[model samples]
Target: MNWGPPRTAHVTMTFDPEGLTRTQREGDACVACHKKWPRPRTRIGRLPDGTALFACPECADALLPQQDDTRSRPQRVAFF
Candidate 1:
């Protein structure tokens, strides 16, 4: 079994001023649920194509093959 991290590249996501919450960012969408949220909940993960994966909490769960609950969400993640 390959219980390891995926190899991907760095990418960036920028939210508009209004995209700060779940009731402000218009037209925001969740890639997993395919539903529109005022602001999409996202976590930074790696994609197969060497890019960052922007996904909702639920999607993040499915993205990872293994389930690891030990690591809680970071208070503030700054990706540069």
Candidate 2:
């Protein structure tokens, strides 16, 4: 199966022991988009520490950090 360009949403995925065991016994799991894209086999991406990022290329791109951090700021207290 091949996944050319990712086209799904970004989602954080924790490694499941059963899933790992299954893949070890067999091989990489077939992604739903495999039939859509016939190249670049769209598999999961892992972080340096082995965290899995289960999302398509497009979704991944959208997940990139944005310039704005104001929305995450704590409420300001008014001083007398």
Candidate 3:
């Protein structure tokens, strides 16, 4: 099979599970704020055992670094 890059890649760094609770470690709660009412679906990072850590959309944005906007800049000119 010649499939391209993975549909969803987790580039976030792995977090230490030292002080995390069972629910957070199990992905049932947001790893950042620990909100349980709405199940966190954004995969923020992973644990030592490869357990995917999740967080709410807001938390995810806060955790992840802001993307640079390069499209709006004018093209650069090179001089000989």
Candidate 4:
């Protein structure tokens, strides 16, 4: 994987063994690694079984980039 610049949190954050936990309410385990911690609203997606994917910044950073087609190169579209 070429891997481009990071666009998410936890790329630099050291992994907390227990990870971060939800402060608002109960939540599902992280979809990528099943770690029970996600930012207040980082909704990943739904599983084939229809389960919601909630992930911490670390898991998000790790999984999201691999899914991104553009790795080393800069993105072409400007969001701002």
Best-performing candidate as measured by lDDT: 3
Model 3: per-residue Cα lDDT over 1-80, one tens digit each: 63532222247678899989999999999999999878887788889989988888788888876766668978688975
TM per candidate comes to 0.32, 0.24, 0.72, 0.36
Q: What is the C-alpha lDDT of each candidate?
A: 0.44, 0.38, 0.80, 0.45
How does candidate 4 fare on TM-score? 0.36
**3 versus 4: better TM-score goes to:** 3
Arrange candidates, best TM-score first: 3, 4, 1, 2
lDDT at 58 for candidate 4? 68
Write the candidate numbers in order of decreasing lDDT. Answer: 3, 4, 1, 2
Q: Candidate 4, clashing residue pairs?
A: 4-71
The residue-level lDDT of candidate 3 at 62 comes to 86
If both were scored by lDDT, which would come out higher, candidate 1 or candidate 3? 3
Candidate 4 C-alpha lDDT tens digits along 1-80: 63532343333223333343443123456644556543423554443444344556766655554544465886597686
lDDT of 2 by residue, 3-74 (tens): 444442234333344344333222233222222232222334544455443433543355433344466767
Q: Is candidate 1 or candidate 4 better by TM-score?
A: 4
What TM value does model 3 have? 0.72
